[model samples]
Target: MSMRVAVVTGAARGIGLAVAQRLASVGMKVVMADLRDAAQAASMVNRDLCAGVDADVSDEASVQQLVAGVVARYGRLDVLVNNAGISPKHGGRKARVEDTALPEWQSVLDINLTGTFLMCRAALPHMRAAGWGRIVNLSSQAGRSRSAVTGAHYAASKAGILGFSRILAEEVGGDGITVNCVAPGRIATAMAAAVPETVNQEIAARIPLARLGTAAEVADAVSFLVSEQAAYLTGVTLDVNGGYFMA
Candidate 1:
């Protein structure tokens, strides 16, 4: 049997990169997709088991080309980790809803929400044809509850992912495809480092872990969701928030 092919978007760094490395380490042929430095990142993961592709998930054409290229090279796409997202900040602070710019709002939705839609749409047929697939969309704690650290647009896009994953899971379950979400809170990634250190410390003080979560920890949750052990699970949101939020 051929090795399973997994594509991870925004994989040049942070949680996406960690997930790619984890999947590759498990013997899957991993494709790390990002707008920049993807090839370099993939090389760092495993030169023989990983390949990188530059893609703009928000652009329909780019997404189509990305899937086509993956299919051409691997003959199948078994898993997709939609981790590409942007949380714009000003002076390391979230913009107030009333002060948020329209363009910023649109950009967040386009990348965080629409990008996931495009990647899933392009990859579903291939997955259904194979009769097996795993899709893990990255969500945020802000989406699950009120957050002072993230803007409204970021929260909306993430919350939209939860709803989208549920509906898609229902539509594709009969086809052996499982769609789920991982809502991470205050992960110690470059994205999280955008804010002041004191801000993270304050948030950590409120968490049961008393520290920020690691990217690899989040990757571990994703690894399970995409594995056979999780076959019976679908349309569920797994929280990796270190007891910061419970629902």
Candidate 2:
């Protein structure tokens, strides 16, 4: 069989980088896509097993170009890891809803929610053509409940992803494609750095694990979800929160 082609957005660093590395390590030809140029980050991994693309997931035209470039080179897409997102901070904590600006809210929604939809739309047709595909959307613990570390817009975007994944899973299961969401808690990454140190410490202390989860742990879950081992699972939210929240 030919090697699988996996596309992971926001893959220059953090959870996105970790997921790209994990998938590549497993023999998939991984494509690392990010708003920033990813040539350097992609070089850190096996250059032969990985490639990079500059993409702004929030823009429809950019997203289309991203998928087209990947298909033009690899001819097929088997897995999509939608990890591009932002959690904005003001004064080292989430901006209160009343204080949140309209632009901030829209930017978060554009990248976190609409971006996922666009990437899925662009990649799903290829997967359906091949008769198999895996889509893992990065959600958050905030989406499941309330979060002290992120803004309302961040939480709302993630919650929107949950709903979108479920509906898409229902629509595409017959085509041999699976859509799922990975809701991570306070994973130690640049994105999580937006939270105040005190807030992170306090939240960590409350968790049974008593520490922040690492990006690699979340990546491991994502790897499984996209692997053949998880072929039967769809429309489920996998929590990688280290006991911070349970459902």
Candidate 3:
């Protein structure tokens, strides 16, 4: 059998890189996709299983080409980890709704929410044709509640992702595809660096784990959802927040 092909967006660094590395290590043909820096990531990952693409997930044209190029090269796509996202600009968080600019809010939703939507829509044709697929979205704890530091737009986008994943799962379960999400909390990444250190440290002290979550930890959760072991699971949001929020 041919190796399974997987694409993970925003995989140039941090959680995205960790997930891409893990998937590649497991013998999957991992395409590490990102817009900010693609050549750097392609050069860094293991040569055998990882490849990189400078893809802007927010743009439909870019996403179309991204999926097509990957499929053209590998012949199939089995797993998709939508890890590309932003805080305020991409809806991970936003300032006060009234104060936030419409363009900024739209930009956030475009990248964080619309980006995921487009990837899923584009990948579905191939997945449905093959009769098997795995989609793992990177949501956030803020989606469940309010962000301690992130903006409202970020929270709203993530919340939207949760509902979208559930519905997609229900729609495709009969076709041998699973749609799931991972909601991370306080992971130590450049994205999280936006907040002040003093605030970050204070927030870290509140988690039951009493420490920041690692990118690798979140990757593990994502890997699980996309693997055959999770065959029976779908439409669920697995929280990887170090007990920041229960239930």
Candidate 4:
């Protein structure tokens, strides 16, 4: 059997980078996609097993070109990790809904929600042809529940991902493609670091785990969902929130 090929978006750093590293470690040829610094990051992950491609997930042409380049080089694409998203803050704090500009809202939706849609659309054909695939879209605790730390646009975009994954999962299960989501909460990443330290400390006090979750922890969940062991699972939202929220 040929080596499996995986594409991980927003893989230049943080949770995305961690997931890319994990996948490459498992022997899959990984394509680390990001708007910038992706090649450098992929080199750090595994020069022999990983390649980085520049792509704007929100742009349809860019997405098509990205997947085309991957298939051209690797001959197949078996896994897609849609981890590209943005949670913008204002003056180090979440902007209230009333304060959020139209552009900001559209930007969040374009990247977080629409980007996932575009990537899946472009990759589904390859997966169907191969008769196997795994797709894991990154959601957030803000999407699962109320969040004071994130803006409304962020919450909406993340929630949209959950809905989108569920429908896609149902549609593609017959094709041997499993689509699912990983909703992380209070993860200690650069995104979370945008807030005040005291804010994070207060959040930690409320969680059962008593601390923020790590990027690797979230990556672990993603790794499982994309593995053969999880073949029977589809349309599920695996929460990696450290008991912060239960549904």
Candidate 5:
């Protein structure tokens, strides 16, 4: 088969960038979309199959442009990775839900949950036409339960992704498209580092692996689902938590 074309949201940095880079490494053409400029990220990562486009996953029109831009260049969409998400301004950033602003809560839902929906909805037509597609949503351990470090909105949005993926998986399975989610545990990143050293140590100590996960590790899980290996694995939430929370 020819190299697959994929759109990875929030690909400017951190986990999103890692996922985009991983896919590109595997002969996939990746369109790196982010709320911020992706030029720097594109320059830093593998360039052969990677391109950057500024996009706000939270906006309907922006998402439309994103899909159109990719299909315009790549001709088809083989994968959609919904990795663009925001920590609730008040909560996930070390504040409690009660302390969070209304905008923060709504923004979290808009990007984390609604953003995923928009991307999937916009990409569905293209996938149905091709009769093959892979939709991977970036969920988190918070989705499974309230994380000590995450706010209510962040947890709620991630959890919403799980339910959304399951329903969409069933809706599109017959069309040769698979929908799934990957919930990552604490990874060695700026966001994860926000937790105090004490907190980090405590969480890591509790994990069977006794360490935090790497972005590449999360990428590996996503890579599998988008590959032929996971054709039958739809509507599943693969935990890349490294024994942090096993369910």
Candidate 6:
């Protein structure tokens, strides 16, 4: 089989970087997209199969450029991972809805929800033309249930993803394109590190696995979802939460 091409957003570090590396390991040419420069991260991966490109998923022009660059170099797009998001923190805690600023809420929705929509819209044409594609949207456990740690905006954006993905799956199923989501819970990333150590420990204690999940673990789940083995799967949300929030 010809090597497939994948684009991973928010890949400068943490879960996104881990996903990029995992895809590359499986022989897919990977494009690591982020707001910040990801050359260093991409270099650490197999250079021949990976390249870093700067992009802000919330911006249409930037997303277009990012995908164009990938196509210009790789000639095709087989997978897209929408992982860029923002969960604003104030002194190690999410702001209460009563105190949350409009700008903060809009910004989260833009990047977390709107960004995912833009990426899928931009990539779907390519995928449809090719007649095969895989899209994985990153959601959170907070989206499925009331969140104790995250704010309303964050939870709302994630919940929106589930609805958006299901509808898209229905629309694209006949085109050989699959749209799925992954809801992660308290994964150990830079974003998650903002939580107080005491809180982290408490969350871990409640999880059936008795620990915060690792980025690589989440990446493995993504790898499976994008693989041929998951060809029959679509419109599903696989939880990588270590049993913290079981559906």
| Candidate 4 vs. true structure, TM-score | 0.99
lDDT of 6 by residue, 1-247 (tens): 7899999999989999999999999999999988887787898887898898888999999988888888888789999999999899999999999999999999999999999999999999899999999999999999998888999999999999999999999999999999999999999999998879898999999999999999999999899999999999999999998887878
Clashes of each: 0, 0, 8, 0, 0, 0
Q: lDDT tens string, model 2, 96-170?
A: 999999999999999999999999999989999999999999999999988877899999999999999999999
Which residue pairs show collisions in model 6?
Answer: none
Residue pairs with clashing backbones, model 4: none
Model 1 over residues 89-179: C-alpha lDDT tens digits?
9999999999999999999999999999999999999999999999999999999999999999999999999999999999999999999
Worst 10-residue lDDT window, candidate 5? 88-97
What's the TM-score of each model vs. the native? 0.99, 0.98, 0.96, 0.99, 0.96, 0.98
- Identify the superior model by TM-score, candidate 1 or candidate 3: 1
Model 4 stretches with alpha carbons more than 4 Å out = none
> What TM-score does prediction 3 earn?
0.96
Per-residue C-alpha lDDT of model 5 across residues 131-177, encoded as one tens digit per residue: 99999999999999758888888899999999999999999999999
lDDT of 4 by residue, 1-247 (tens): 8899999999999999999999988889999999999999999999999998889999999999999999998889999999999999988899998899999999999999999999999999999999999999999999999999999999999999999999999999999999999999999999999999999999999999999999999999999999989999999999998899999
Q: How many backbone clashes does candidate 2 have?
A: 0
> What local lDDT score does residue 73 receive in model 2, on the 0 to 100 scale?
96
Model 4: lowest-lDDT 10 consecutive positions: 89-98
Q: What CA RMSD would candidate 5 show? A: 1.5
**What TM-score would you give candidate 6 relative to the actual structure?**
0.98
